[model samples]
Target: MVKKTDVLVIGAGPAGIISALTAKRYYPDKNILVMKDVKNGCIPCGIPYMFWSLKNPDDNKLGMDSLKKNNIDVILGKAVTVDRENKIVAASDGEEYKYEKLILAFGSNPIKPPIAGIDKAGIYPILKDMDYLKTVIGELKDAKNVLVLGGGFIGVEFADEFSKISGLNVYLAEILPRLLGNSFDEEFSVLAEEKLKEQGVQVLTNNKVTEFLGEKKVQGVRFDSGEEIKIDGAILGIGAVPNTDIASNAKLGIGKGKGIWVDEYMRTSDPDIFAVGDCAEKKDFYTRRRASVMLASTATAEARIAGANLYRLKVVRENKGTIAIYSTYVDGLVLGSAGLTEQSAKKEGFEIISSASETIDKHPGSLPGSNKIQVKLIFSKHSGILMGGQVVGGISAGEVINIIGMAIQQRVSMSELETLQMATHPYLTSAPTMYPIVIAAQNAAAKV
Candidate 1:
């Protein structure tokens, strides 16, 4: 049987759902349908919380009620092929859907490194599917020792969550010298390591897992230094690769990063199709080089662009490359990084000045729940324009980095930031006289 839709979005992830809903809002008269292989999808970021804070995987499920309320159709099936010549998508079961405009948000797959015994039964890779994660959670229920490979956000979060369970020994191993090496500076990364260590997690840095030891199931891991650690199970969070098989099969243009090549308006080489999310190629905001950032936030932003411009360019917005904004919480501390770090700017050969300030989040330093907030701002020495920022503090740090992101996007300079105005309350924020961001900008300006 053949089905027809005005806009067909393949994949029900953040990108796919946002794109379909955005299309529905822009083109109210059109029929929009989103299809994915999984019937129940868990919130991607909330997956780690399921092990402890959330109790079960089902507790972190992503609901389709919003799609239903917007009159968007949802289908549960895996798309096997895309016939771009006829603008049709075929499912494995021989079902077909014809579309006027197609959006590919096929997402990504976890990367499994070529290590010996990697295919053991007790080894699991982080997946977005609900059922698969539930099974993994079940398997980990009786596990006393768990090893998590990779020190990225996913791996750190998994290690933290798994460590929360009583009697479970969680070990996090990373090849990099510090945790969160790609996003934050050494200071921030070291702080994360310190915090994780305080939480009873064995944090190993600059170590390579050469082999997974086991007979039929993973029992432990051997490091390059000839050290072995016994583990009941292992979770691989090394990274992910874009799922562009269908796009490649359809002869769509692929980027250097192995993602579907897309223009600023989220259009593929073929005008009738568009791509977004983890499966779509991204470019760096500063260098304009192809980047491999696959965050759900970035995906939703791209989806909005593609959805609005499906029929015509109604929205005047376009993606200006990726800024790579990231934030995470380990224990009670919140860490956020936006744009480039000091190390990244220096590596990129930019003459940069960095300034850091430490202050209490609440005024007077005597308020209850007050925490020390640290802000680091990086600026171009020549232009004095804000290039990046990092924050480590209480819950407010998450939103503070967003302000710095806007500064980078709008090309705000240190001078402008020094005199920036913000509303402050004694209970909510630091004193107006000693705001961390403003002070940090002032320090940078003095250096300039």
Candidate 2:
């Protein structure tokens, strides 16, 4: 059977949903349909919290009410083939979809490293599918020792969540020198390591998993140091790769990072088709080189850009580049980073100056719930342009880093930030005189 739509979205993840909704908002008269494989989807970012923090796992479900209310059509099936010539997609649902415009938001697949015994039964690769996650949770209900590989944000978060289990021995191992090394500098990485250790999570840094050990199921992992430890279950958080099978089958260009290549407007090689989310290639905001950054925030931004410019480029939204903004929480501590880190900037050969400021989140350090917030700003020494920023503190740090992200996007300079004005409250934010961002910028500006 042949079904036709004005705009057909090939996935229902964050990017797909946003693109569909945005298209509907801009072109209200267009018929929009979203196709997805999974009937139930979990909030990708909230998946780790489902293991401990969330009282009910279902609370993390990606609600479809918004789609229903907006009158966007949805179909469940896997896209198998894309006939670009015919402008149709063949799906496992046994239907042929014809679209005036096609948006490919196929998302990504978790990376399962090529280690011996990796196919063991007790190993779980973090997937966005809720049903699979529920099964993994059920299997781990009585687990005593759990090992999580990779010390990235997801791995660290999973280790912290598993540590919350009354009697679980959670272990987080990273090949890098410190946790979050790729995104944060040593000081911030060490801070996260310390917090995880304080939560009773055994953090093993500079450890490489040589192999997964067991006959039928993973019973232990062998590290590069010739050390092995028994584990009841294991989780793989190495990362993910773009799912571009359909696009590749259609002969669409792939980027250096293995994602579908898209222009600034999120349009693929075939102008009639568009791609977004994890499946789309991203360029570094500074270097303009291919970057592997897969965040729902970044995906939605691309979605908005693609959706708005699909037919006529109505909104003038263009994806300049990905800034690689990230935020994660461990216990009561929240860490947020945007753009490049000081270490990364130095490694990238950018003459950079960085400054740090520490202050109480609320005025009067004696406040009952006050927390010390540390902000670090990195700037190009020659241009004085903000390159990146990191914040470590209470919940405020999450939103604080976003401000830094905006500053980086707008090319805000140290001088501009020094005189930046912001609303401050005794109970809500740090004292105006000691605002961390402004202070850090001022300190850097003085050196400049």
Q: Per-residue lDDT of 207-299 in model 2, one digit per residue for the tens? A: 999989888978899999999999989999999999999999999999999999999999999998999999999999999999989999999
TM per model? Answer: 0.99, 0.99
Q: How well does candidate 2 match the true structure in TM-score terms?
A: 0.99
Q: Return the lDDT, model 2, position 50.
A: 92
Candidate 1 wrong stretches, greater than 4 Å:
none
Positional deviation of 399 in candidate 2, in angstroms? 0.9
Residue-wise lDDT of candidate 1 within 1-448, one digit each (tens)? 6899999999999999999999999999999999989888989989889888986568899999999999999988999999998889999878999999999999999999999999999899988988988899898889989999999888989888887899999999999888999899999989888989999999989899999998998889999999999999999999999999999999999999999999988999999999999999999999998887889999999999999999897547788889989899999888999999999999999999999999999998899999899999999999999999999999989899999999998989999999999999988998999999999999998886
